[model samples]
Structure formats: C-alpha cells, structure tokens
Target: MDITIEHLARARLITTEDREIPVSATLRYTTCDPLAVYVDFPAEAALDGEEVTWTFARSLLDQGLRAPAGHGDVQIWPCGRTRTVVEFHSPYGLALLQFQASALRRFLVCTYGVVGSGQEDMAAVVERGLSALFGGV
Candidate 1:
C-alpha cells in the first residue's frame, strides 16, 4: 500500500537584502515515490501566480539538518541552531527560504514512520521510475 504523509510548515523567505518574508508550505512524502520530498508553494508566492512544487531528494533535506547538502538547482543548509535554509535556483531567478528546524524534523519523523529511510523497496521504485519514463512517451 502507498502511504502519504503531509506536514504544514511555516517558512521565511530570505531575500537578497536579508529580509525575511513569511510563507507556508506543504511538505509531502509518499511511499509511491520514496526517494523524493516535495515542497508545494502557493500561487501567491510564485512569479507566474501559479502554485509551484519543488522536488528534491529526501536524503538531502535530512542531511541538511546537520550540515550543508545539495548543489545546483537546490541547496539546503543549516542556518544556526534552530533554522534551516533551502535555496532554489531557476531561469526566473532564486529563492532562499528559511524554515524552522523543529518543523522539518517533525515532518521527517512522520516520513520515517511511513517508509523508514533506507528501507524503501527499490525494485518497485525503479520499476515505477522506468514506467513513468517510457510510459509518458
């Protein structure tokens, strides 16, 4: 059975001037795609005025809580003791978001309960990945 877990987290956008803008995101995880985590940003937060969903490795967010992780389009790092920063890059520009560490930890805990990191059924995951790849063709 596929299990889905969702958590609502309050995050702050760190602008170039170092100003913080508040935003809320829906953090989602599911056994259907166990290796990835999705962050859904509301339409108001997007330049195109449409909801945005950023997908990245689940392990990246987990490692980032302790130290810096990721590169390229997404970068996540610890921002002191109680906050974590997740940066997104795109053709449009950049987005730097700061989120409460506790909220992220809580959300990860929920995911672990559902899929238990490192315990995912990779055979199934890979098969599904391949299907999604060629099926869309």
Candidate 2:
C-alpha cells in the first residue's frame, strides 16, 4: 500500500523535563517515489522559524525505531499503536508525537521495498548488526 500523508490536523512536542520551550509544530508528508517527511516550526521571537526534512530510506525502516542506550543527545522509540516517543537530550526534554501508523508503514513500503516473509528470521541479525554499527543499542 502506498501511504501518503494528506495533512496533519495538529502535532505537539512534549518535554519529559522542566523546560519552557514551545512545542508547537506542523507535520507534512509529501508524496513521491520515496516519501518526504517535513516538520516545520512557526516563527517566534525565540526561533526565526525553521523546517527540517527527513528522507526515508529502506534500511532505516527495516531497523525500526531505536534509542541510544545510557545517555545520548536524542532518543526515538515506538509507543503504543499510533504514538512515537522522541526525546531530545538538549536541555533535557522529550516529545510524544502522535501519527498514523498506517501512513508510516506505507511510507516505509514506498521508500524501501516490502520486507519478505523469509527476512523475518534475519531481524535479530539485523538488529545486532545495527547495534554494533551504532556502537551498541
């Protein structure tokens, strides 16, 4: 299934620690052979408005979500069915992002070919390889 993001009603970034930072942000998913994910921040006195774009890759989706063990600048993990946990270590904070998992899966499939049933057994090997490449999970 080719999942395309039409529009996001609303999205917010929450902090796990004490911080007075604004968490309002907009998300837009563009349709393409390889989907493009964009997160835009409105202009504010603190920030002059910024937009970040992440290009999906086949290998990334196969690896799934991950977080740096011990301490790290950023952490990412899957939460529940439709939520994702993103933690930023800068100034110590975290954000709970709510998105459609179906859309995510579609984006993954579009970016990277579907994972075959035969590849299921290699999940552990892939994880171990990624962990080693990433300096341990």
Candidate 3:
C-alpha cells in the first residue's frame, strides 16, 4: 500500500491501496491553513498505532499516513474536545476523527484511524461530518 497527497477541487485527497481507502484528508480553508483532516482505518490497524510494539499500522509500507502508538505521538494528539468515533471489527476497527475546521494548521496535526465496514463512504462521511461539525464549511 502507498499513500500520497493530491490537490482536489478545494481539498487534499489522502489515499492508500490505489485510493481504495481514503484514510484521512486535509483541505485548505484560508489559503494559509487547512480546513480539516479526516481519517479511517481498521480495528487492528487502529490498535497498532497506539504503541510502538506494532508498526503494522503506521509502517513505512504506507508512508506516514498512519501513526505509531505512543503517549505523545505528534501524529495522534488529543484535540481539545473533538469526538473520535471508533468502529470496532473482529479483525480490525474503524475510526472517525471529527474536529473543528479552524483547528487545521500548517503542520500535520491530524492522526490516522482504522476504517470499518463502510470505508468506501469515508470521504463523504468526513466531508459531511466536518460540515456538520463546523456548521457549513
């Protein structure tokens, strides 16, 4: 699996496995900052990023799209009051990082999570969730 960032209409598209799983994404909001970052992964994949014991989730295989678990891993930070929804799976899990649009900064502050059952709809879920979270835009 590979990950790359590309310019999409007004947001950045983050993808893996030839775009099969969108994972997470960042969108420029005010020319200088991103509007939001979206992430979705599997249960095992999600758990793997919680500690260095396993690098399967944030492994070099998929670039830096995933986070290696740690107490203060910059990749996965506690964003004030954002609600992180983790969808559990027998073999893996799905997570949704929902946060404020104004929180997006120049640096990559968003964390990666596992994608569960409906991963194909991750982009839409992230888009809608962000829109709802920020109230239009």
Candidate 4:
C-alpha cells in the first residue's frame, strides 16, 4: 500500500522590505509520487489569491539540508543553524520562506521511514504510468 507523510510547518515569509510574515505551509510526501516532495501554501500567501503547491525533487530537500540545492523555479538552502529557506519563483513574483530546520529534518526522516533512499520501486511507478497511458490495456 502507498503511504504518505504530511506535516504542517510554520514559516516566515521574507518580504522585499525585510519584514517577516508568519505563514503556515504543508509539506507532503507520498509513495505515489516517490521522486518528488510537495509544499502547499495557503491562499493568503499567494499573489493571485489562490492556494499554490510546488513540486520538486525529493533529493533536493535532502541535499538542501546540508547545503544549497535546486535551480530554476524552486531553490532550497540552509539558513543559519536552526532554519532553512525555500524560495519559489513565478510569473507573479518570488516567495521566500524560512522554516525551522528541526521540523524539516523530522519530516525528511519520516519520509525515509516510508521509502528508503534508492529503494523506490520505479518499475511499479512506470507500470502505473503505462497503465494510465494505455488504460491498463
């Protein structure tokens, strides 16, 4: 059966003027999307007044905990000793949020509990994809 790890983490949104706006974000990991991690933001935090979710490589999150990782629209890096910063870019603008490093580490550990690194059953994932593409033939 597929398993999921869901976490709610408090974040500080970094504004251009150097102000911090407290926001709540949802972190999600699931066997169904084994290669990716998802972070969801509420409508209040969006420029278009709608909830937004960004998906990026799961490895990026793990690497970012040690150093900077990712490129393009999403980037993650360590912030000081107790925090992490994840930045998202879009046509509207950029959202930079700081999260507790401990919280992120806990979440990452939980994900590993469900699916160990390099242990993903890619054949199953591809089978599902082909099933969807061909309607299980």
Best candidate (score: lDDT): 1
lDDT of 1 by residue, 74-118 (tens): 999999999999999999999999999999999998999888888
Q: Which numbered prediction scores highest in TM-score against the true structure?
A: 1
In candidate 2, what are the lDDT values of residues 32-117, reduced to their tens digit? 32323444445541223444333332333334443222235434455676654444343423334444445445544543343332
lDDT of each candidate versus the true structure: 0.93, 0.42, 0.30, 0.92
Candidate 4 has an lDDT of: 0.92
Clashes within 3 Å, all models in order: 0, 0, 14, 0
- Please, what are the lDDT tens digits per residue for candidate 4 over residues 1-137? 88888999999999999999999999999998798899999999888889999999889999999999989998999999999999999888898999999999999999988998998889988988899999884
List residue ranges in candidate 4 displaced over 4 A. Answer: 130-137
Model 1 ranges off by over 4 Å = none
Better of 2 and 3 by lDDT: 2
Which tens-of-lDDT digit does each residue in 11-59 have in candidate 3?
A: 2222333332333432321211122333333343334664211122222
Question: Which whole-number lDDT from 0 to 100 does residue 35 have in model 1?
Answer: 93
lDDT of 2 at 11: 35
Model 3, C-alpha of 57: deviation from truth (Å): 15
Full candidate order by lDDT, most accurate first: 1, 4, 2, 3
lDDT of 4 at 118: 97
Number of clashes found in candidate 4: 0
Clashing pairs in 1: none
